[model samples]
Target: MPEVPRTADPFTAADLVLLNGTVRTMDRAGTTRTALAARGGRVLAVDDDAAVRGLIGPRTRVLDLQGRCAVPGFIETHNHPTFFGLTLAADVDAGSPPNATIADIVARVEQAAADAEPGTWVRGYRYDDTLLADDRHPTRADLDPVSRDRPVCLQHVSGHFCVLNTAGLRLLGIDRNTPDPVGGAIHRDAAGEPDGVLAETAAFAAHAAMPKPETADLAEAIGLAGDAYLAAGVTTVHDTGLGLVGGPAELDAYRLARRKGRLRNRVRAYLVQDLFPGLSGGELSPVEAGVAGLGDDLFRVAGVKLWADGSLQGLTGCVSEGYACAPDKNGLLIFPQDDLSRRVATLHEAGWQVAIHGNGDGAIQAILEAYAKLGLDPLEGDRRHRIEHCQMVSERQLDQMAAAGILASFFIKHVYYWGDRHRDRFLGPERARRIDPLASAVKHGVTFGLHSDTPVVPVPPLEGIWCAVRRTTRDGHELGPEQAVDVDTALRGYTSQAAHLGFEEREKGSLEPGKLADIAVLSADPGAVAPDAVRALQVDATVIGGEVVWGGAGLDAAPAAGPAAGGGDGR
Candidate 1:
């Protein structure tokens, strides 16, 4: 831990102050304070109401929190802002709540086609085959009725698979003779024809083939996503896929969003490795030309994002053992071991944080081997290289990760969204119970953070924290009681631990005197409430850089007299 820097003047006037609230500093000792003051967008002091009142000036805005609780703002370790925004703006919602069956999804697509201009593609997203009444993925024949003239593409909830209509497949130039790309598959019917189902790289290719959104539209979408994140109390986000939509154009959209004052949360971008071919070439890539911390506080190019496998729910993750639902079908790796090793070495040697998505134990092993092959040792320096998702990590893998100082960002929300199916259909009881394995990771001393993988799931940190602490399935059954972490640990996963994943722990995370004034004011303290009720806590206000960006309203005005004139019992 670093020392909190103080100003030369002991009694510097604060720009903002909050009195009569429970301020959870989230420091090393889990300290709690009654009142807090901020100056120059950084925390100035946090102490008893009377003590902090001394720093409040006439110009200082003082918010009476009553008996509410305030803690460090949530940090999202892994998310897809571009994809999430695009889906929200243009794609049809095929998720379970809206579409109960394949026919429902087809009807939605048919409606979209009817609404769209001729030759325009109709796209739908977040359809879960498992959750559908049909209990299977929709095929080309099912979607063909929506449009023989217009193309239709429906993406699985996992984002690793997609079902395309005949026109959609042809639009992407896929046919019976089109061989599957390395590390991806094109499902074929018994008659030796493409079945319109593409997985991994194949799905990625189809997405890339689609038309890119206009820059202004993309910027608006990003702004919408940012508003959603801020409403959910997220102050910082790690965009795990930067080039998901239009490569450099996506980057341009971010710049536009910032310029238009639409970007709300601080962003740490991880460029998709496949977008830059020069990474594997002799010369330096465009991203490599810049240093790791290339941008301002609002946005920065932090690392290179890679993938070792696909989603576990999509049944495309590379598992060591076959899925219980499909005995002969152990998922496939997205990259050959050697190729993955080369990519890791290339990005690692170039001084970029390499974050690889690995959802299965087999993929995790492959990633570990790649690191071992390069002889990369984090003990020498804090590389902080991370394994994203890490859903199916084993005890041995946890030990190795701890030894190597490799951090993990777990998609802990899976327990709440897909735990029952995972337990009974995917991994069987034993393996499914170990999904995420937060307790084992703590015991093995592996530094880890929790994530929603949002747009795959909703972007609610409280929900993620509740899931980590409860380990309960949607069916209201406990999937892994032994793996449940304490309330404090679960909160840390979204706060301090998440900041550590992005190498911004000292700057944000905790509400120290020198740290940025990024805090979330909740209706109640998560720790004070029952574990099951944690997710029910409402975010009353979100403060970023000493400014209330959401839900403040009349609270933004300064006190008429001074902090002493209006002070509560520091509840």
Candidate 2:
């Protein structure tokens, strides 16, 4: 076990002591504390109210918490900060109501085109076809009205597909003669001409061609994203898909942001697999890392990320069995099996954690095989290689995972965002019943974690917890009741387990004295509430290293009444 700090003298009191609160330490023993003190960035003490009060000195900033519930701030396991910031800062938000139609999407794009620099791209994101009134993806024809001269790119809600206008396609040189890349498709019209719909790697190509943002602009994007995450009580985020920050300039953008004091929370990043030089198999040079590659505490590169397949919703996630919705397709795999295994072995041999994006069963199988071939075990040591969206895992695979010490960072929010679609369209009920199988993973002793896969789904931690606990879809349908976990386990998905996913458990996850003093102040205790009431627990404030970064109990609007009488997490 690790050491926990204790208070010294009253004369040298800690920097801050948040007392008189119901704080869940989220430790394995389920310890609870009424007060905690912090000196440096790390926690100083966890003691009872009276003893904690005795240590408070004239210089200490004390927060009463007013009986609010405090837990370790959320550590997001899978998110894209650059994309999150970029989308939030520039793109049209077509994910919500009033813009849930193709016409609305076009109108929004038109407005953005008018505002954007002439000849610059008009970008929009997060348009869900299922929620749209038209119930279909917008095409080049629909987007032409938005911008005939300027390129237009509308990212799909799944983040696996994107629609481009004719001008955008021309900019990227996609036409009838362009052959589809392996494992990805450029959807073609009946005449065999490209239809401006790019899936999987094809979409990535279009994104790569777009004009890169200035470093300061990128920094601002990161700052905007950090503000949102902090406001939502996310103290740490493991930024996946470093390919978005592809070049040296993009990588430097992060260090510049941190140097400028724009980074508020911790960042653990994974560079894209392609960034490493090699065709058959290769290793990442530290020189390629620039400065952000090597890390201190605030920002670090945890590993390399590889995408083995696409998304389940986008129907590109590699699967053994055929899709229930689209009978002809079983989805696609990005790399040849031999190529993938070699790459995985190369990285594993280099002793770096590898995070693979796999959704369907085939992708999961490939990743598991790759790790097993290396004879690695995380439980035995700290070999925390991960499967990013292990959504379609099998029962036997779960056992193998536990035995091999593999980690599954399930996209649990799929239950809320695409659970109904999965049931009715994607997986059919039988397989859909197992999406994000938290309970089964627990049963098999797999060290599983949950994530929102932000920008794909908004980064709302409470809503994510709610999804894991209730297993309810957007339409109030329970997709997998048996898979639903208790509130404690769900909270752990966001806190402790999330830290373990990033190999950051010792420093940031739990509210231990030695851990960083990152805390989220909730209106009520999650464990004290009924499973369904968990989502309604408003985040009153968030503390990062004892400094209040967001809503404070007294600084912001007062919280609503505490947990109601009906719900109870009193397990």
Candidate 3:
């Protein structure tokens, strides 16, 4: 024969192939390619020419990217997917909607009452009293006009506070006599009467008191949130806590979603520390339980989440120095230093990852001190513990965290959402500039991830990257120029670094042979574009395990569910 040509073998060809795109591997080698081939939900090969062609056979689905930009799927290290879905289904937007004030909130509630069945609860969310005309939290009297017959619940955007009408209060059995729950207090009036404002665990209790949707409905809503994550170009998320979604039933909710084929993205969950309390009421609770290592690859409870302090924007963060607006208040600590350290040590010694919400320098320092006492050095053991919202920390604290081998995830969105307020009042300009110091963290050689902390902000990685890179406030002023990071570092915060946070680096977060094929296709190369236009870049496709999950030109797909039973990578 004069010539012979080889073709892809039918038996071993790839199931899917993507070609002609800029692929950022995000691996140790920092490989870049224009094509990829996948089989059995894992990457088979990454190449550009004959290598990719040989993987495509008669049964393969070959996608031509036509020169777009593709990177590891955006991984949200911290967020609230199920709760985001639940809020989308049940809560009204009291802030952004036509209702921006308590009066407007009343009007929206009245409208909800018009068609709602009697005795059903009506809920609204994102009600910012600071922005309201009255500049005060809504009280029961304000909600009574809407419907005294039906209970009304309004959640502050921070997810840390809630306002309820009188009926709602009665439903929760609160009449000022209900002393504050441990670690949670009810905001009462000067006369010692409940003012309809519930803080911390009290807020959680009141919100949990609402009638829950059926299991199937809740699962569906959770699925919808997964879909939302995919559409937003996020293929993995860390559901930071589960107290609001059915308590221990939260385990059931996520399990059911995965079993029903509703879960379309990877989830590593953390249960509330309350659910796994080492001690209760300053003493151990009679009933003992666990959530660590629960579920499989699709859903795994990897850690316990404890709140050391409240939100910085809410003026409840435990700061080393007092707030400028309220110099008398230094913010609330959810757990006393001793109790928090004990709980953290218990979990750390048990080999479970502990994720503590630490927003202020005080909280960060306390958490690091607790880690230091553990004595199980990272050089000797697996202590990839996390600090959520490590937004306010000193340089000394960063060095301590680095030495302790602690990982951090920052709520960088705050720079944009509440920067001016933080600068002008919360921390004042000097302390404000250090909030979420991306550049400083990078300089200190500490690994960290960026987050939205959803319900507080949307799950938009591009925006987060923008926030980290620009540090721009709402009014176009750069919050902290020195804190801003470059484009590549910002991208890593969402990709390779995020994988490290979830301990999934070996499997996802990179396009490499033998790894699950998870990739995000962008309309334009994020690095090649002007810095300010990064957020403006649109998602073209999101793939998980070689299958299209979102933005694939009308492709509706689910994530790759590996083995039914697999251990959590608290690696």
Candidate closest to the true structure, highest TM-score? 1
Question: Once model 3 is optimally superposed onto the true structure by TM-score, how far is the C-alpha of residue 378 displaced, in angstroms?
Answer: 1.8
- Candidate 3 stretches with Cα past 4 Å from truth are 1-6, 208-210, 277-291, 554-571
* Per-prediction TM-score to the true structure, in the order listed: 0.95, 0.93, 0.92
A best-first ranking of the candidates according to their lDDT comes to 1, 2, 3
Question: What value does the lDDT take at residue 344 in candidate 3?
Answer: 80
In order, the Cα lDDT scores of the candidates are 0.86, 0.81, 0.79
Q: lDDT tens string, model 1, 1-571?
A: 1111222243467877788889998899999988899898999899987787777665566777777888999999999887888778765888998888988888888888889888888888899999999998999989887689999888888989999999989988999999999889999999989999999999998888888778988888889888888888899999998987677788899999999998888999998976667755534656465667789878999998999999887788999999999979888898788788888887777788989999999999999998877675676888899999999999999999998999999999999999999999999999999999999999999999999987899998999999999999999999989999999999999998889999998998899999999989888889999999999998888888987788765443333532232332111
| Candidate 3 residue-wise lDDT at 9 | 77
Cα lDDT of model 3 by residue, 90-175, tens digit: 64677644555678888887888766788888877777766677877888888888778888888888888888888899988999
Pick by lDDT: which candidate is best? 1
Clashes of each: 0, 3, 1
TM-score of 2: 0.93
Worst 10 residues of 3 by lDDT: 562-571
Which consecutive 10 residues in model 1 have the weakest lDDT in total?
A: 1-10
